[model samples]
Target: MPRLPPAPSKHPSVLGVDIGGTGMKGGIVRLGHGPKSGTLRGDRFRLDTPQPALPATMARTLAQIVSELDHREKAPDADSRVGVCFPSIVQRGVCRSANNIDPSWIGVSLQDTFEDALQRPVTVVNDADAAGLAEARYGAGAGVPGLVMVITLGTGIGGAMINDGVLVPNFEVGSLELDGVMAESRASAKAREREGLDWPEYALRLQRFFSHLERIFSPDLFIVGGGISKRPHDYLPLLQLETPIVPAMLQNNAGIVGAALAAHADPADGLLR
Candidate 1:
């Protein structure tokens, strides 16, 4: 891997916004030493996602959140870029789906919307992809060699593929069919909750899903994320596979931290500093 450029010495900070179905949260991520070495400068602020959540309204809300967080910083860093984690498939700077938020997000240029709203350079990425980036850089997959896959088991399974520290964005492995059913339909966190399956049963479902993935990608490491990561021992111990699987470290903060990381790191460069 090539040596990464050092972070800005004078004012190394960026705003990270996580847009979800229910609420939007943002904070200033202080780049301590490198892109992965980021921490919230202040408390993160959140606002309920607007009703209808139209593109225009959401942009205004994001602007407000940026303003709120920017003011909290000791000194306004003009070079601070903005990164947003949107709960949709972002392709070529455009959002391709609107599963949780308003359907208007489809075909919207989210990167442009956020840039126009904040009057600054912006990087927009999928929420799950952002979370996976965080994990690969600073969480479970950190320093791990070979292919690493971050699988978020929430309402749906969201996957992110990373080789070393480089991200392979938008790898939706969850949509794959297993036993004639979408993998997520049977193994997602929502499926466990809806079915009232105990940890052992849920682990079995995860084992099946992981086994399917192992057959294809043969990833070296698997980092399981999402809200369920809090209770890793409950389910992780039950799984038995050749590939090592572990829970995410940053947990809920991964998306925000990774957004900030992505904002600072150039996309042309595969690895984050």
Candidate 2:
């Protein structure tokens, strides 16, 4: 397996933004020299996602976050770049599919939009992929061997697959069909809430979904993330599976940290290759 290029030392920190359905968040992340070495430089700045979340409106809101975070840093580098994690399947800076955000995002060049808005180079990636990269490098999956699957149980299921510290971007396992329905439709946190399922009920759905994944991919490890990860005891143990499972250590910050890591590495080079 190929190793990821070292993060540039001269620009030890960079801004990472996570664009979500309900909020947009950003922060400066300090890159360290070893595994699990990323840390937030200061408090993260957030703003409500615009109601429509169209490309232009979202870009403006993102610019505000970038401006706020840059101001807070107080020593902005003109050459420093920005990394954004968006809820879509991004390919070569363009969004191929929209999830949670506006349909207008489809086919939009997130890189160009954000760069035009913030006046800096931008690296855009899938939110789940960003979270997985962060976990694989600086959180739960750090130093873990073999294939690791990072699953975010949020409003919808989000997934990332990493092997030997290399990320396989946009895995989209949540879209898999389970029992004739989209897996996330029945297993996601939103589903649990919508159906008023207790932990045990939710675990039953998760068990089916994970078991399907196990039969197909047989990943070595599973890292469950999102706000629900804070309460691993509530659902993790209830589901019986062959693969070892753990909660994400970074919680909500994984996407931000991972986006910074991607920016620091320069995504054009193929992030985490």
Candidate 3:
């Protein structure tokens, strides 16, 4: 297999936006020479994801957010690229599914829409894939050379599989079925909250779920992500598995940083669309 592009040096910066169910966040990531070296150019910005979350409605909000970020720069870097991470399966710039957002997003050519809205090139990808890429490149999974699986335990489960820093986008482990139900429905953080399962109870479910993953892929490392990762003490200690599982280091910023890193790489590179 061809080697992936070398990571950008510490000079260039790119804008990365992560669009989620409740809120959207963005920042400018300065490319760096080592893991954990990149820094946001300014404070990150967030805005509410439009109600109804329709394509056109969300596009307008995203445009406004990008403009706001642009205005913050004293002199905008014309070469800086923009990347947008969506909470859906994206392929060839087209969205394949919409679970948290409006169904209208399905089959939409979001790449064209965002490029038109921003008046520049924009790369779109799955939000989980973006976060996983960041973790593999610069966070918990950094330097691990074998299969690394990063799962986001949020309103729904999202997964990304990477090997030696190369991302396998839109893996969709969340869709796996267990007990005739979507795995996310039973094991996601939201599911735990909705079912009112305490830490130990939730940990048991996660233990079974992750053991299933280990059976299938035997990943070298597993990075657990999402807002709940902030308190790993609540759950991480209870699950026992052969694979080394750890909380994500970048937390919510992973998607933004990873999106920016993607923007810095060649467009034709074999990352997800």
For model 2, which pairs clash? none
Summarize candidate 1's per-residue lDDT along 201-258 as a digit string, tens digits: 8888888899989999999999989889999989998988999988899887888877
Alpha carbon lDDT of residue 3, candidate 2?
Answer: 40
lDDT (10s digit) by residue, model 2, range 42-134? 788889999988999999999888878877744348557888998888888898886577898898888888899988889888899889988
- The predicted structure with the larger TM-score, 2 or 3, is 3
Colliding residue pairs in candidate 1: none
Q: What ranking of all candidate models by lDDT puts the best one first? A: 2, 3, 1
lDDT of the structure predicted as candidate 1 = 0.80
Flag regions of model 3 displaced more than 4 Å. Answer: 1-4, 34-36, 74-79
Tens digits of per-residue lDDT, candidate 3, 1-273, equal 212356776557688999999999988787767544555778889999989999888898888878888877632464456989999988889999987889988999989988877788888989998898788777888778989999999998999898876787788988998668999999999999999999999999999889999999999999999898898999888988999999999998988987887777786776654
Each model's lDDT comes to: 0.80, 0.85, 0.84
Off by over 4 Å in 1: 1-11, 32-36, 75-79, 267-273
Clashing pairs in 3: none
Q: What is the lDDT of residue 268 in candidate 3?
A: 70
TM-scores of the models, in the given order?
0.88, 0.94, 0.95
